[model samples]
Target: MTEPLGAYGSVVEMLEAAATRAPDHPALVCEQVELTYARYRDCVAALAADLARDGIGAGDRVGLLMGNSAQIAVATFGVQAAGAQVVPLNPAYTESELGPVLKDADLALLIHDAGLEELAGAAAPKGTRCLIVGPGARDLTQPTGAPPAPLSLPDPQTLSTLQYTGGTTGAAKGVDLRHAAVAVNVAQREALLPTGPDERVLAITPLFHVYAVAMGLYLAANCGGTLHIVPKFTAAAVLRDIERHRITFLSASPTIFQALLRDPAFAETDLSSLRVCSSGSSALSAEVLHRWEEATGCAICEGYGQTEAGPVLTYNALHGPRRAGTVGVPVPATEIEIVDTDTGLVPLAPGAAGEIRARGPQLMAGYRNRPEETAATLRDGWLYTGDIGRMDDAGHLVICDRKKDMVVTAGYNVFPREIEEVLFAMPGVADAAVVGVADDYRGEMLCAFVVGAEGDLPEERIRAHLAERLAKYKWPRDIRCLAALPKTAVGKTDKKELRQVASVPPSEPA
Candidate 1:
């Protein structure tokens, strides 16, 4: 097994070491541009110096509002190198969606894509300064006659990233992760899924998400490997890059994987270069997993995590027996427990279902500015993950569903994941989600929303399929099919929208 990158005070130090180890090696590749490790470090240092000159340092919050590109990657490390907390915002957010976050973060500077300048201006506060950057990071990489100023390296415990949670459940809260925590999580993931210097990582997920940063960006930097960034996700584009770039490692969501499988080009695409693939952000259905692995000959290692736990708590070991339908054991130094959902005090035995709680060095310090929530979530050294799951006898975790997403109808508790899995296995069902809507007699009713492979899906077919697989109570009271399901910024199914839509009367079934 390849050894993990030992230790780093901050993520910036990881980049510095990579640059020193392989100066001329390609570090970042996006579209028509590529930057070597040395050039990548130089761009970060240059941006850091510029931010430092503007009086942005420790205790200041800087927002990076851009899509997945070489420029955003540089800006991320640059802000942290200058000793400020980097807040990564989604450039796709409307001004209304961005306004509350802008006001809440109290940012000193917001570096954004040139195209998003108008949105940034409308959303940012009056005194907040905004810097516009283009696609290739040309402005940051340009040579200045004078040497760049020394970076203001932060203390290990200093707050580094203030990543906001995807608002799938409710309002998005900023997760406060320290420099040491972020660096340690990278090392933790490396311990289980080791990568070498020759590795080529393809990153289609948004860079703003913690999963992308830890698994895609920092993971590549730790090994002095090349990170290929895709600004957007399209089946054709991803398939083309994988074959063209000879990508060895890929980290993406189930939605992305399903799209690739549905594309006509997938059958002919040369995926022989893919050695490792990871799925996160949401659950991966058994049907999709089987199809993908059978076609590509690469097992998709499904993992479980949240933004609060440095975005990684557990992952399937690369060399071990990969279990189907379970997110594998906790990474090194992480302790996980199945606690009773009600009081969260009693520990449950293996094979018993309960809330999953964990404690680890990579855990976030707390949610920013939300003391009450922090106290409730982080207690007795454990982060109370509100996700409901069970630990198998073999120590693998089976995620049932989120606590809030569970349904109680006719006095029977039902997990949406169970029914959704059944839905995913049905032919013509491309994507599926289940939400509990209020009902007068049943207290709450299970409503399933599905996206068909080609056109409108027949509700009767879904009902017939569920009838054979699931219990009568587990069957959805209503089945609605659409062209596409609403997704959160991080590519999670937005159940909140489904619940809202399900509240209204159902139209005639297709």
Candidate 2:
């Protein structure tokens, strides 16, 4: 039987323990700034005290709107330390996109970067207080001349984080995660892919993303390791950081790995220090996997999860046999089964494709103020993950596609990911996505968008490639070549945008 990894009551406690164990150890590094564990803990305690004085405490939702920075990390843990839930928002959101979420969250305070004051003021509802930190504003990472106060620690079930979804399908809903759930997930991930105090982790993704929070932020704190933060992703900068910092662990998306391979510096950069690398947020193509491992001599362990599952469900095991095409077995203390999509009650045998359902300590409490959606998504103590997948005989999970993204052509059902994989393996194809569009005769037709390696790829070439690997029913009726595919905030391909583009009539099918 698998047991829980640690006994921390909350994620804040995890940070405090790390600080006590290694006060002088490096905790965070972002560009020219660095903080020791002792100093980092002091900053968080000071922020918590200030927030308490301002009347922000339990039940208050505090919005953190900013890009990747050391200060954002301080604000995330500090708000929770003060007994309030932290609502991390993507700073890239426009006023229109930020308004509804701000209104829905009913935040008591919003902490944002300097340049976003105008957008925060315009979008946030009246009476919602705003705090700016960054250039020309107060620094969250600095102590405010006040002695640190005793931490307002939370119990296991106390709500700690309110993470908003990407809303690719529709409006984003808040995923409510409690203190124990978030902290336990860090231990769960550590069980599968262990890290040590000597580890140096490079975080290139946005800190607001759950993937970055669990695997990058919390994971580093769990082991008292150094976390190197990058404000933005550029192939050149990432390559330089790994070699400069002697980064040992990297967790990134397949898009980032692909971009790194294309950069000229990737070949010369020293990645010898990298010990464990993980890929998540989207499917990792086998071609990219093979290329990356061959070049770096390091395996890429791809995991699977949604924001509702505390963002991590399964990851390739570090100490055991690692598979190429599977997301690997469930993390410690997690139970997963493939259930029929119609009812989501009957469990299917191995190799049968169905909806992936999971029950674990890492599961979220529910959607915030969305009782009906919570009920529909969580039934009988199981999270009916709208993802479709199958389990192999060895217990490895194979993700097929999302239930909502499945396309029906003529009378047959088709999964776009299967065709997208084939396109990814083709020569001169840099990126690809498949979406279903409304059709008169077939009810729904598949449309494919391809990004080329160098220049515009011939449509006939893509058609010929698909015709040989896929059946007649699976072929996309229309093909389009793009310079680059649109991406969501978390770096997944924006299929909704592609569907909108595919709906428009073209002079001829590419």
| lDDT by residue (tens digit), candidate 2, 103-203 | 98999899999998888998899988999999888897778786696566877789999998743344668999999989888888888898888999999
lDDT of 1 by residue, 377-422 (tens): 9999999998999999899999976765566564344668767777
lDDT for 11 (candidate 1): 86
- Residue 156 Cα positional deviation in candidate 2, in Å, after optimal superposition: 2.0
lDDT of each candidate versus the true structure: 0.85, 0.86
Error of 2 at 406 (Å): 9.4
Which ten contiguous residues of candidate 2 have the minimum total lDDT?
404-413
Best by TM-score: 2
TM-score to true structure, per model: 0.81, 0.82
